[model samples]
Target: MAKVSISLDAELVVEVMVLAGIGSPQDAIEAVVRDYVVRGHRTEARTELKDRNLREVDAKPQEPQG
Candidate 1:
């Protein structure tokens, strides 16, 4: 783990703490950063699928009775 020193607005920190349901400022910041990274990954994946003209298929197995 890397330790970083950052300056943030007190109000913003409070808001992030509330939204993330975390009391530690570090946890709140890490949560926000992780969410941001995941969102970027999802966006990239969607764009790649769109470029390939690919759509997700729903393939449900049907039960056959004699």
Candidate 2:
């Protein structure tokens, strides 16, 4: 992927790094952004499937095997 640089507050970056448990600032920001994108995709998929006629499965527990 292409790379670019931007300035951010040191305090904010530190906060994100700690919250994400990543020692590197770049990796921490990248991880958070990637997760946000994934969540957006998931939300879009759920909304699109909301009106679809999908089959539901009911799972039942089986007796324990000896």
Candidate 3:
């Protein structure tokens, strides 16, 4: 684990600690970052699937073989 030194809004830190039910500021921030990263990955995957489906729909259909 890496140690980071950052300055955050004092009140916001207190709020995150309460909202996240975490005892430390570091834990709260880590939790929030993790959630954000996960959401971004999910969104990227959904977009790729949507684009692929659209391409498939736009392609010409082939005739059936006898």
Candidate 4:
């Protein structure tokens, strides 16, 4: 894994640390980043499925009943 540095709000960092029960900001940030990446990839795959002809099958409009 490549190392990268990012600046985060102190308050936000504290909040994440508390919620994650982690001692370091790095773990919280990595967990959040990994979740974000996974979600993004899932969304992108869904879009590709739509692009690949998953047509919406709308029910034919029924004629007014006599």
Candidate 5:
């Protein structure tokens, strides 16, 4: 993995460390970012499937079963 150096507020980093229960600021930030990305991917997957299913069902003609 490539490492990049960026500046962030000390107070914000401390908050993230506390919330994530991670002693290292870098680890805490990385964990939080990874979690956010995972959640976004999961949400996109679920919604994309749901939308496609709805459109497919609506486009098809349903016959009444006797």
Candidate 6:
């Protein structure tokens, strides 16, 4: 797996460590990244569904000619 470097505030780091009981800052950061990725995927899926629904509505057939 690839590695990433991110900067965090001192207070935030302490809070994460206290809340999660994680041994290292990296573990807490990884957890946050995983959650972010999962939420992003969900948002993308919702956006795609909305777009598809709009297209279906636009493609609906009109009334038959007299």
What TM-score does candidate 4 get on C-alpha atoms?
A: 0.68
Candidate 3 residue runs with Cα over 4 Å from true position: 61-66
Q: Which stretches of candidate 6 lie over 4 Å from their true place?
A: 64-66
Count of clashing residue pairs in every prediction = 0, 0, 0, 0, 0, 0
| Candidate 6 root-mean-square deviation in Å | 2.7
Q: Is candidate 1 or candidate 4 better by TM-score?
A: 1
23-55, model 1: which lDDT tens digit per residue? Answer: 999899999999999999999999998866643
* Superposed Cα RMSD, model 3: 4.7
Task: Name the regions of candidate 1 deviating beyond 4 angstroms.
Answer: 54-66
In candidate 6, what residue range of length 10 has the lowest lDDT sum? 14-23
Off by over 4 Å in 5: 62-66
The number of clashing residue pairs in model 3 is 0
Q: lDDT of each prediction vs. the true structure?
A: 0.88, 0.87, 0.93, 0.84, 0.98, 0.87
Which of the two, 3 or 6, has more lDDT? 3
Per-candidate TM-scores read 0.72, 0.75, 0.79, 0.68, 0.85, 0.73
TM-score of 6: 0.73
- The weakest ten consecutive residues by lDDT in model 5 span 56-65
By summed lDDT, the worst window of 10 consecutive residues in model 4 runs over 53-62
Q: Which stretches of candidate 4 lie over 4 Å from their true place?
A: 54-66
- Among these predictions, the greatest TM-score belongs to 5
lDDT of 2 by residue, 1-66 (tens): 899899999999999999999999999999999999999999989977764534322244557899
- Stretches of candidate 2 off by over 4 Å are 53-66
Which of candidates 4 and 5 is the stronger one according to lDDT? 5
Best by lDDT: 5
In the order shown, the candidates' Cα RMSDs to the true structure are 9.3, 10.3, 4.7, 4.9, 3.4, 2.7
